[model samples]
Target: MRYETRLYNALGVRLTAEHSLSTGQYEFMWFIGGWDGCGANDLAIAVGATSKGVDCMEAAGW
Candidate 1:
């Protein structure tokens, strides 16, 4: 089957974070929301860190 390509706006709710170190581009993510409210799109914009995630904003002290 042939594939189709497209551009995405901020409203796109990323289904997954497919990071590409070579080009720094994410692919195969799904966009699932409307862009209207200021913070409404914030949740859809950023993905939460997993249990093994690194938090630079957190304190270094254990």
Candidate 2:
């Protein structure tokens, strides 16, 4: 059997749509959408990500 992959951008990372969110991406989206008063550090911790990730998201038009 063979599997097909779809490439897309999440933040600035080129990722396969078939794969689930990375540890950080999932948390970032969740915190941003579900909570209030979320700061940069808060988002970083929530997503286990860094400023670069944020930059990527921003460039992606988030």
Q: Number of the top candidate by TM-score?
A: 2
| Position 33, candidate 1: lDDT | 22
lDDT of 1: 0.26
For candidate 2, lDDT tens digit of each residue in 1-62?
Answer: 12222222343243325334454575567678787876678655555456777778777666
Clashes of each: 0, 1
Candidate 1 TM-score versus the reference: 0.15
For candidate 1, the C-alpha RMSD (Å) to the true structure equals 11.2
**Candidate 2, position 1, lDDT:** 17
* TM values, all candidates: 0.15, 0.43
| lDDT agreement with native, every candidate | 0.26, 0.57
Over the stretch 1-62, how does candidate 1's per-residue lDDT look in tens digits? Answer: 12222324321334223321111112211121243442323433344432112132123221
Measured over all alpha carbons after superposition, the RMSD of each candidate to the real structure, in angstroms, is: 11.2, 7.6
lDDT for position 22 in model 2: 57
After superposing candidate 2, which stretches have Cα over 4 Å from the reference? 1-24, 45-49
